[model samples]
Target: MTESQPHLLFSFGTLLDRQVQTALFGRTVATTPAALAGYATRPLAITDEAVIATSGQDVHLTLERRLGSTVEGAVLRLTDEELAAADAYEVADYARRQVLLTSGETAWAYLDANPLRSAARIVIVGDSIAYGRCDPQGGWTGHLAAAHIAANETQNRVFNLAVPGSTLADVSAQTPALLPPRHPDTLIVAAGINDSAVPLAAPGDGHDGLAHLTGHLDSLAATARRHNARLVVVGPVWLDETRTGDYEGLRFTTDRALALRTALRAWCADHHIDFLDLWEPLRDQPHLLVDGLHPDAAGHKELHRHLDALG
Candidate 1:
């Protein structure tokens, strides 16, 4: 981006301290009440002497994700420069990701982006979320792929294998052909909305929709294991009220959205996959959906913010 513009930011830790906030940005910023979904705060001791001294405390709240918890915090309308300042104040233990607040607004927040390894060969397989059926500006993965290409660090490379409307069932059957001869070292699978669609109450084939979906997930996991690749799965997001009607023919609903997240969580547990369950964070932020489905340009930034941290 030509100098990333200002964005909304959510802080759950010491950044809440006016002293620490002022020390970093040289002024106290006006903040409003806001909260992060699916996160809980616990005491973590600060090892950095400077941070301890500056904030006048060694114990600060560190965040962990739990399905039913929330992290109450202050929301700052920050300029790009202020965000950079905040980044400098956080220790290596913290990384940034975007979150949809309970306020129906999306904002960047500091989260753990711990990875076993920095990805070198990335293969993305999914429907429009991966394909970016989005705002005129485009999708988050597109920007992520571009950043990796530009950096040329870690010998990073991206293979965009996503096609609009393709689900796990389609991907499972087609993966062998979909992958390039140069296999991926890291696989990112983000698909569900398309699969959740019933397409006119036609959930076909005499099986529970959720159960059948998990079977397809198994095929996806098997393919990734065959490549000896690290797997990451992003879950379905909350849809918009207006967009809900369009899927009437497709048999998709917010309830189906919940089923998809639950199935993905179970599947990830069974297979030891890294899962980014978006349903929790995006559940209350239906306004972020652009076409009642996909994230708009800013929402794409929100999604990419989480995915980019994988690097």
Candidate 2:
């Protein structure tokens, strides 16, 4: 729609933030709280950052009728100039499309487009952090979503398929059955911390440390290439230093976390995948975390900055 087209822009998550809205969309657009249907939002833990998700994890994704339960959000009505500016901001990851409102009428708006629908799907597959745990905003999922929303005002659907405590074996087990037959436009994998926590001496270990991590990452890259999706490998967030419980009968420390990050980065660079060293900026910011495991409010803010840097 043209800037003067009297458009309705649907906003969720950080875009819901008044300050963030004013900063990005300008003051001319009128925003009314609104929601979309068939989805619930959750947080992903990756340092302290604001990210959210509508799918994946233990959260039951509600697949109601196209006119089912509504997600509350702001309906931004903007002048042509404001809309144009908003479009520029959102052209990275989202696109404008008409959606069936709860009333069964089509309202022109923006939504995530399935990469397969146009180019290829870019999938984010990982564990609790990738699924968003601490920030309650789905961590990078929220960042990716907001950025996607801003980057691709033309509409591109991004999918996050991560589960808490998910092991490399879990992904391997599910890939054949759950993954789409085709590759995605991009594939991001954030995992291995929980798996590494398992004591190496344990019998019947679920993941084999570097070997497992390397294998799984390789598999992910192969799958992405098969589907023609850009592959990105994200490093794990550090453990909550305050919470020291026996993980697989072993102790965890910052050194261990840093080692993991190093390994993952090496693998990504070696494999020629897009790597986001999410840990470097915030790994030292332990105070930004919640319960030593997830990112606190400050952490989420820092994460947003990192994501912005990637852009």
Candidate 3:
């Protein structure tokens, strides 16, 4: 297809709704009657609040490959921008794939990428905050694990491999655990604060530190890409100046933390990786920190809320 030509997208579900189309594309998309062969429709439950509100339904039809079945739908002509909008509208449960229609036309369709492995396996690695630290319940990762267990029985799995006082180098070394035979569906990295605190011992130390951090982050992203897993980098939270200062003869300041968070956010954006900013959310909440360095039980609960919303 030419760059100027609109892309053809086969819609077998919510995209058929005029309201959903308007909400996603700011206008109704032009569509023609079409049918997809070798696929059958199945009801996929929706948990995202925004998606449910937009489509006006808690469940939507998803395509599954079948031998002798055909799914009736419409072929939507969408611009590049509109196609990206459609992508953002879809939840992680669906992935777009190119397929041939009954009319001998090629179109993109959102399909159930893993029907059998529906449950998600998320692996987390970072520093103390991700390790749950001062929180008696292990922290936000712990809370997320419990919630998933409650909602999906024993199907879902969350692995927390955070280490206390770990840096980007430390987390990068842990990437091998996520490779091959048993790779997770998603990889969450909650580092940067520790690396930010490293004092510049020399004139060029600051520049070197940043370059090293970038290399480590790229390594982590490469590992995730090898397994086709989603990578999410959780930015560092602000520190309380009154209760936190130099540790083990090295200085730790809010300025450095903020700078590192900004860098991490920018890197994630450029690489198309997911980034969750915790700096602003926890900046004014001093009560959530027990030692000014780690989050308390309430703080961990707050973190859980934000991460849960990503689903």
CA-lDDT, candidates in order: 0.71, 0.57, 0.77
Worst 10 residues of 2 by lDDT: 58-67
Question: Which numbered prediction scores highest in TM-score against the true structure?
Answer: 3
- What TM-score would every model get versus the actual structure? 0.59, 0.55, 0.65
Model 3, 1-311: lDDT tens per residue? 65878889999888999999999999998889999765678899999999999999999988754445678989999999999999998998886755667887767778664422233567789989999999889998899878866766544667888898889998998767754544465678998787877563543454534557789999998777555456678898778867875566446678778788889989876765667777765678899888777889999898887766655
Predicted candidate 1 versus true structure: per-residue lDDT over 172-193, tens digit per residue = 7877666657566567888877
Following a full C-alpha superposition, what root-mean-square deviation does model 2 have from the true structure? 16.0
Can you write out model 2's per-residue Cα lDDT over 1-311, one digit (the tens) per residue? 64345666666645455665566555434566665554333332222122222111221211111112356666776666666665554433444544434444334454342222232235677887777777666676766666665655544456778888787667656654445642344566777776566463663655446556777777766665444344566776656666745654655566667777888888766654556767766776668777666676567667667766653
Candidate 3: worst 10 consecutive residues by lDDT?
112-121
Per lDDT, what order, best first? 3, 1, 2
Q: Assess candidate 3 and give its TM-score to the true structure.
A: 0.65
TM-score of 1: 0.59
Q: Which parts of model 3 have CA positions greater than 4 angstroms off?
A: 1-119, 178-182, 200-208, 309-311
Model 3 lDDT at residue 102: 81
Which one wins by lDDT: 2 or 3? 3
